[model samples]
Target: MSSTLTVTGGAPLKGSVAVRGAKNFVTKAMVASLLGETTSRLRNVPDISDVAVVRGLLELHGVRVSEGAEDGELVLDPADVEVAAVADIDAHAGSSRIPVLFCGPLVHRLGEAFIPDLGGCRIGDRPINYHLDVLRQFGAVVDKRPSGIALSAPRRLRGTRISLPYPSVGTTEQVLLTAVRAEGVTELRNAAVEPEVLDLIAVLQKMGSIISVDTDRVIRIEGVDSLTGYEHRALPDRIEAASWGAAALATGGDVYVEGARQPDMMTFLNTFRKIGGAFDVDDSGIRFMHPGGPLRSIALETDVHPGFMTDWQQPLVVALTQAQGLSILHETVYENRLGFTDALVRMGATIQVYRECLGSTPCRFGAQDFRHSAVVSGPTRLQGADITVPDLRGGFSQLIAALAADGTSRVHGIDLIDRGYEHFAEKLAALGAQAVRDEEPARV
Candidate 1:
């Protein structure tokens, strides 16, 4: 049976919580360990289901994953890495999209890699075609079966020039993982340079890969003949930090998210300030809260990198419901991320979804007739309602709405949030939010 959360709303949440390594970067870095000649130590690892999923996949491929020198650290030994049976991989893979990332490292080491049917959040058309295309460009053969895809590199995989249709983070990561081991120089155009991607690049550099980033969204990598394991700390999760900042705004409370860095979150920080939310950043972390005043509404847009992140828009939308006027948001990264706002509408939020682009940016989805724009009319007093968790970010967005509403709210399918957010219920309690697991049946 699935777990649910019963939340009593209309209370302010205050206090502090710590964020660890990013779920996006840490998982990819674990896959990168496969290319190492020795053991790799990854620090600041968060306790999230996605990390466990990656660990399971690594162990299945004969990599030894163990505890590091201290807590929130992982030691990955790729010295004895060997190919495992297909059934073993599928059995351990579960419903994770991480297996697709293993294609490059596995092919480079064992010359063949089998991928299980990949699954992740139902965000949008996040296809593996781009990854497969990149692999094929690097002289890898792709074969599709009922179970999953199999990739084989018959000859020494050599680097090739590639250009992405969009600046996709996953595809860019796949190329980085593959190109670092190829025989020659690889150039990528229209590449995504998200901070998480840069952290992965740093991990690769620590392992002896020579990569250069050009100013015009171009990345060049010179494959090294060999690589050693790396000892490095992963970057903190900016998405999680921004979610908590939005929580502080939605609940009209103060929250100090320790370990949140400013450089990576500059875009989000500036946007949060324009909304009339208060924040203070130091060397440790950022403290976010709502000052007693009228919250102003503003037009916002989500983009790839160096722009407002699409992941940050969900929870921030909950906070926008408390703003004095309408706030328009254009989601360019993912077309369907705004679908989660329907539950908010059920909880007395005034949100209208439109096919046209609503914000300042003209995105590719503008002409595609997708419901990519949302106009939030707010300062609406939200009431409690039963809701189901949709995806990772959306699940947290649901929790924010439930906490901002009056009375109690029953939230089901909350286990999905474990995929990203670490120890969220504990963090909520520490913040003085009345959120508890509902062991009993729901009240109808």
Candidate 2:
């Protein structure tokens, strides 16, 4: 759906809001259900498009996905999973990053499987080469086909030691899901220990999977003979929480983000403090407010877990525009993520993309043009203008920029935002922001 945002400029949003299950975590957990020997029950599921897309993909496999009366509850049965949907599977592979995760489970259950192309944010060339390497280590013969990825393993899969070149969340989850059913123990080094990955591990553990996380970026999973179903509650969306929190900071308002857990926000909180954003945490949720001090610019570098998340960079950058002085942002995750700043420039923010990475840290954006890094000269006036969203967190940054700007701003391609944010319109309305769901102007 299309969205038009009209803001009067410089209005601090004041209200209480709540978040739901994480889009990233829930979608992968849905894929995890395929490994279940019995029905798996998942609660706190978000009503986002990505979840629906995954549900449709499961149904194509003959899995039954039924929603509960309560919001975000689901019953998943994998007994009817179809092993031969090359065309349908190919179509969905380009939709989200979770589709490639089916490789291991499909290989374990049917001894053969095909997965279509995978799709997600265009921040970088997120290749599945690492995933394929790990799968091969598990004794699966994998090949790339014109339609999708084809795999076969007549022999019982044997787990082997694998290492990731990067701490990719998708790659880590893929290895975890596939290795669990293989024979012997699998060791993964340089794994992505995102909270979502840990949450999926928790679900897998309940389903009788043996996995262990070491302090030094190591993960050990033992392949089991059979697996049972599980009842699990999805983790809260930390990226969404940070988005709203950044919105509050950008708009100079106070918002209590309900259902926002603090355990996942230490990095964000520390960064927010550097910008003079104040917050308090309670059992109900967290509250964000600017302490009426000058917003200071700070250096930020994105890394894997226990570090600032790459997903949170774009939205937080918008808030940085209101801060004083030059803020140095080095994106170490994806190369092309900084492109979203161009949209923000149209709305009157002073940001310059750079090819030279100046920071001393080991950032990934050094070779790439502005796609990797940017300099935000903030404390500038932002006026509302029509803008189009390019990605998930970038979409929310557009909304935050529009709300902070004067006059009306129309944000198109908002359906992309629904892939992550749940009930966003309703939440924005509740928080005293005048945002509406409207159709775009008909082409002449």
Candidate 1: worst-modelled 10 consecutive residues by lDDT: 435-444
The deviation in Å at residue 140 for candidate 2 is 1.7
Which tens-of-lDDT digit does each residue in 109-188 have in candidate 2? Answer: 88887777778877678888887887888898988778777889979889888888778898899889998888999999
- Local distance difference test values of all predictions, in order: 0.93, 0.85
Each model's TM-score?
0.98, 0.96
Report the backbone clash tally of model 1: 0
Off by over 4 Å in 1: 438-444
Residue-level lDDT for 240 in candidate 2: 92
Full-model lDDT, candidate 2 = 0.85
lDDT for model 1, on a 0 to 1 scale?
0.93
